[model samples]
Target: MEKHIHNTSLFSKSAALTLTAVNVILFFITEAFPSVRAYLSLNSVLIIHGRMYWQFISYMFVHGSLMHLLGNMLGLVFFGTAVERKLGTKQFLILYFSSGLASGALSFAVYAAAGMNHVFLLGASGAVYAVLLVFSVLFPRTLIYLWGLLPVPAPILVAVFALIEIFSQLFSVNSGIAHTTHLSGFAAAWLYVKIRMKKSPLALWKEAYRK
Candidate 1:
C-alpha cells in the first residue's frame, strides 16, 4: 500500500512535467502541420474505418487552441505533481494513461453508438480531470483558489466541477465541450483509487475533514 503522506518538491523532475513538455511541443508541431492534428485527434470514423487506433492515446497530447493547451497543462502541473509524489512515477503514469484511455474508449463507444463519427475530440481534459480528482482525494483539505480568489477546499471544487459537467452534458450537448470525457475521467480515477489504491475517495475526504 502506498503511504498517504509524501514529501517532494513541486518543481523537481517528474513525469507530470515531462507530460506537460510533450503536450506543449506537440501543440507547436501540430500547429505547424495542421494535417498532424487530424491524425492525432480522436475520431470515431478514423478509428473504426481507417484503423487509426493510435488516436486514442495521441488525442490527449493534441489541443485545439492555445487556451486549451494552457488550461490542461496548468492542471497537470498543479495537481499531477502532488499525485505523482504520493503514488510514485510508475503508479502515477498508470493512473494517468489508464484514465485517459478509458475516457477515450468510453467516448468512442458513445460516438459509434450515436453515429456521430464526424466529431473530433482532442485535448488532455480527460486525463487532466483524472489527475485533479486524484489530487483532491490525496489532499482533501488543500485550498484551491477560484479565479485567483475565494479559497475552496479541493474536494468541494471537484464536486462542483462534476455537477457542472453533468449539467452541461445533459442540457448543453452542442457546447463543443467533451463533458462525457471529463466525467469519464472522474469515474476512471475513482475506480483506480478504489481497486488499485484500496481506498474510497469519499471516506478519505471525510476522514480529512473530521481530523
Candidate 2:
C-alpha cells in the first residue's frame, strides 16, 4: 500500500473559511464578557503559575490584547485549517485543546515546583504553536512572510523563534513573550502527533527533531 501523501497549502477555501468564523467568534465572546473571564487571564500567583484548572481549555479562546488575538487568530487560520482538514476536524480539535491544556499544565507545574502560588494564562497561542509545529513537520519547504517585508522558510522561522525565545528567557530583562508556554505548546503538539501516528515522538525526532 502506498502512503497517502497530501498537499499542505494553507491558502485554501476551507481553511480560510474556518479561520474567519473562529476569529469573529473569539473576538465577540471575549469582548462581550470581561468580568467572568478575569480568572481566565494568564497571571503568576505568589508562587504558582498559569492558573490552570478547567480554564485551561477556555483560556485558549481568550486573549489579553487586541494584537495578541489578531496575531494568534491569523496564525490559526493560516496554519491550522489546512492541517485540520488533513487530520479531520475532530482530530484537529482534539490536538488543539489538548495542546492548550498541556501548555497550561506544564506552566503550572513549573511554577508550583518553584513554590509559586497560582498563575493565570490565556490566549490561543498554544493552539497556534501546535499549528506551527504541524506545518513545520509536514511541509518543511513552506515559506512564511515575516513582518510584511522579509520572507523566510518555515523551518528556519521556527528554529529562529525557538532560539530567540530561549535566549530571552535566559537573559532578556523585559521580554513579554511567553517562551515557556510556547515550548510547552510545541511539546504538546509533538505528543499529539506521536500518539495519533503511533510513532515515538523521540524516534521521530531523528527525522525532524522538531516540535
Candidate 3:
C-alpha cells in the first residue's frame, strides 16, 4: 500500500514540473524568435475570422513578460503540484487544459460583446487560477502567506482574488490583466470540482445555510 501510494504521488509532481519547464522553455524560445509569438500567442480577430482556434491552447504556454512567466510558474509549482496529487495526473491535465480552453472561449465572447474583438490575450493565468482555486477548495483551512508574512486561510484568499478580478472586469480597468479570463477559470474550475465530487454546485451553499 505504501509503494502504491508513493507511485501515485510521483506522477503528479513530475507532471507539474514538466508543465512549469515547458512554460519557461517556450518563453525563452519566443524571446529568441519573436516571430514565433504570432503563431503561438492569442489574436482575437484572427481567431474569429481566420479560424486560428489553436490559439486557445497555444496561448496558455506563452507569456507576455519575464515577470508574468515567473509569477505563473511559481503558482504552477506551488498549487499545481498539490492539486495534481489530489486529482492524479490524468485528471490534473484535464483540469488544467479544460479550464484554459474555457477561459479562452469566455474571453472571446466578452471581447466580441464589448466590440473589442481585436484585443488579444496571452498567458497561463487562467489555468493557474483554476489550480489555485482547486487548492483552496481541497485545503480550505490551510494558511497561505501573503508576501511571506500575513497568513490567510486558503478559501478566504481565493475569495479575495475572485472578488478583485470581478471588480476589475466590471470597471474595465486599465490594469492590462485579463480579469474576465481569470473569473472564467474560477467558474470553470468550480463547476468541474462540483461534478468531480458528484455534488451540485449549490450544495456547499446549502450546507452552509443549514449550518
Candidate 4:
C-alpha cells in the first residue's frame, strides 16, 4: 500500500490538470445551457425519484457560479498538485473521488432525512476540502497564505476550517453553502488517510510541530 501510494510511475496523466480543465469547460457549457445544470447537480428528488444517479459523480464537476468554480480550481491547483506529486496520481485520484462520492452519499442521506428534496448540491468544494486535509497531513509543517497575506501552517488551517464548518452547520444551516458536505469531506479524507495510508493525521501533525 505504501509503495502504491508513493509510486508516481503508476500513472502518467495529471489528474489535477485534467480535473481543472473539465471543471472549467463544464462551467462554461453549463452556463450557456442552464438546463444542463439540473442533470449535473445533485438533487435528492431527482436521484431518488427520477433515478438520476449519475449526479453523484457529475456534481463534483459542476459549480453554481464563477466564483465557486474558481475557488475550487485554485485549491485543486495549489494543494492537489503537491499531493499528487507526493502520493502519486493514483492515490490522489482515489482521495479526490472517494472523498467526493462519500460526501455526496452522506449528504443525500441527510437531505433525504431532513426533507430537503429540492436542495441541489453542486461544486467540488467537498473533494477540494479532502485534498486540503490530506495536504496538511502529508505536509503538516508547510505554510499556506490566507488570501495571500497571513501565513498559517497547513494543519492549523485545516483545523480552523473544520471549526468554521462545524459552526456554520450548527448555527447557519440555511447558508446555502453545504457546510455539512464540507465537514463530510473532511471526515471522508481523514478516514482515507487513516485506513488507506495507515497514518494518523493527528500524530503526523504533532510530530511535525515538535520539530
Instruction: Return the top candidate by lDDT.
Output: 1
Score each candidate by Cα lDDT.
Answer: 0.93, 0.69, 0.85, 0.92
What's the ranking of the predictions by TM-score, best on top?
1, 4, 3, 2
Steric overlap count per candidate:
0, 11, 0, 0
Candidate 3 lDDT over 101-202, as tens digits, reads 999888877777778865778899999999988887776667899999999977778889988998887897856899988998999889898889776434
**lDDT tens string, model 4, 23-100?**
999999999998999999999999999999999999999998999999999999899999999999899999999999
lDDT of 2 by residue, 1-211 (tens): 8897676753443643465466557667768887645655544462233434556566666777788878897888788877777787777777777788788777767656665454456777876887788767666667788887788877678778777767877885344666778888888878876777777443544466454
lDDT of 1 by residue, 1-211 (tens): 8768564854355999989999999999999999999999999999999999999999999999999999999999999989999999999999999999999999999999999978999999999999999999988989999899999999999999999999999998557999999999999999998997588899888888898
Candidate 4: Cα lDDT at 117: 79
Q: Scored by Cα lDDT, where does model 1 land? A: 0.93
Q: Whole-model lDDT, candidate 2?
A: 0.69
| Winner by TM-score between candidate 4 and candidate 3 | 4
How high a TM-score does candidate 2 get?
A: 0.74
Question: What are the runs in model 4 whose C-alpha is more than 4 Å off?
Answer: 1-12
- The TM-score of predicted model 1 comes to 0.93
Residue 138, candidate 3: C-alpha displacement in angstroms: 1.0
